[model samples]
Target chain A: MKTLLMTISRDLKVAYRNPADVINPLVFFVIVISLFPLGISPSADVLVGIAPGVIWVAALLSCLLSFELMFRSDYEDGSLEQMTFGSGPFILVIMGKIVSHWIMTGLPLALLSPLLGMMLFVPPPGLTALMLSLLLATPTLSLLGSVGAGLTVGLRKGGVLVAILVLPLFVPVLILATAMVQTGIQGGDYTGHMLWLGALLAIATGISPLATSAAVRISLSH
Target chain B: MLNVRNLTCIRDERVLFENLSFSLGAGEALRVEGSNGTGKTTLLRILAGLYEDYEGEVDWALDEFPLYVGHKPGVKDLLTATENLTWLSALQEGQVAPDAVRAALAQVNLRGFEDVSCGSMSEGQRKRVNLARLYLTRASAWILDEPFSAIDVSGIAALEERMNDHVLAGGLLLLITHQQLQLDCAVRSLRLGV
Candidate 1:
């Protein structure tokens, strides 16, 4: 527990030291969502109908944009190698890093969802649903993204490969999140949607750390 | 004791090394030497448990985890030198006080540069910051990959003294380096590619 906390705090310190790292994804989220109104349709009705899917997809892409850097610095500077042979289990340190990274990037993106939803003309009732779905769903993306990041940490051009490897895995959460917000916008029961998103989050929390650890070890082989 | 038998590593349709074996007991140092692309670093990494796609066995008997210092400094660019050492060393053993980090930096001759970010430091300085961990731990075994490379003449000499002291103090040293060192202990050499 001490080791995990130390790792989490250390990662937080590192993330904070470079404010751009924490802010880049948020900027991407805003810019991408902002562009939707410019490029697609400015009609509030069309925007309202597509708001949930647009916001969720934009969040997913912004999260993906930040995934490559998640472990790239550690892998480059050899910190990952040290942690692998360190006393604490490598999986736990990875989990700690992921959680702290989410706190930096995912949490804020979720918090900003309401304003982005309002810009998209989403109903006021769906604002809470958007925030809640993003809160539960982005961490799942981070968890799933870690596996792709770890697998490609050693590759020369890992950015595109990470998206290819991880975006397919993100479809279920995107669907469930959009479904919940759409249902909320329609004044229908969305309890089942939250339950499904919760189930996905639970499973991702359970398996991703282990998969990421194994992927990191395997990356050293190539 | 650290023992290996018939280790073989093949990377991308090319055999880096095969049919290799060696052993190290307490109070000993093993120097891995080879030409470029001959698997010296690969062997050291195998010893350090960083890479594990080989067909062999690594049997180590130690009280705690071993230390591995690789080619890169492992210091975060956004973190100050002191912060990098204090935190990275914590992953190995908990409760790494700030004083220990300072002491380790001093041992590596990096006293005044503690607060500076690693991104701005020179290559040799960054390497020194990484080497400070050697002063921070009491681990039984050390696996260093090219510990002497990218270091200055005096830095190399100081590191030799540290290696001698570690082995003399009964700690095992498994390292890869092209620059030979003068040590006051039994030093074993393994030359890959025959």
Candidate 2:
């Protein structure tokens, strides 16, 4: 437990000192969100119709933008290997990293989504739903992305490979989260969608750290 | 407290080393000497359990994991020297006090620069920040790959003296280096790519 907290705090400290890393993805999220109304159509009807998907896709892409921050530096500098050989279970180290990655990228993006939803003309109910769905779903993005990041940490040009490997897994959360927002916009109960998203988060929280550790071990092997 | 037998590593379908074997007990230093691409680092990684694509038995009889300082040195550029040491020591479950971390940084000749972020330090200074772990380690064995590279003459002498003290106190040392040892203890050398 101490090891886990220490690793999380260490990563947080590093991320805090490097503010650019934390801020860049949020900037990407905002830019991507704003570009939709400009590029597609500025009409309120069209903008409101596409707001949930636009916000969710932007959030996913922004999370994707920050995946490199999770393990690349640690892998390059050999800290990941040292953590693997540490006294604590390697999964705890991975969990700490995943948590910190979410804190840096996922949490902030979720917090910033409501504003983007409003800009895109999403209704109040939909904006609330957008925020809630992101809060529950973005961690899954970070969790699942960690596996891809770990698998490709040793490779150059791993960003494309990680996107290819991880985006397919993200399809379910994207579908469910978008549905939840649409249902809210329609004044319908979206509790079922929320339950499914919750279950995905639970399973991802249960499994991703272990899978990431295995992938990391494979990459670390010479 | 370390043992290996019939260790053969084949990388990229080329045999780097085959049918190699060695062992080290407490109070011994083994220097892995070889030219570049001769698999010295590979051998160290295999022993350190960072590399697993090999056919052999490498065993540590001790309960504690060996302290390994590899080529990358694991220093984070955004972190201060003290922060790096504190977290690195925490990886091994070592509850290093703030004063001890300061002392370790000082021992590495980073006394006044302890709070400086590693990104702003020289390469040698950054390397020294990683080497500072030597002062705070609790493990019985040390596996160092090119520990002297990028370090100054006085820093190298300080490290040599520290290694001498470690081995004399019955700690095991497995190192890969090109520098000749000036330690008081007997040094065993192993050449790879033979």
- Measured by DockQ, the strongest candidate is 2
Q: State the lDDT of candidate 1 residue by residue for B1-194, as single tens digits.
A: 89898889987777888877777899989888889988888787777777777898889998788888889888888899999898878878776988889999988888899999999999999999988889888788998888888899989989989989999999999888888678888899888876
Report the C-alpha lDDT of model 2 over A18-61, residue by residue, as the tens digit: 89999999999999889998899999999998998989998999
Chain B TM-score against the true chain B, candidate 2? 0.98
Off by over 4 Å in 1: B12-14
Task: Report the Cα interface RMSD of each model, rounded to 1 decimal.
Answer: 1.3, 1.2
lDDT of each: 0.88, 0.91
Predicted chain A of model 2: TM-score relative to the true chain A?
A: 0.98
Query: What docking class should model 1 receive?
Result: medium
How large is the interface RMSD of candidate 1? 1.3
Clashing pairs in 1: A77-B74
Off by over 4 Å in 2: none
**DockQ agreement of candidate 2 with the native complex:** 0.77
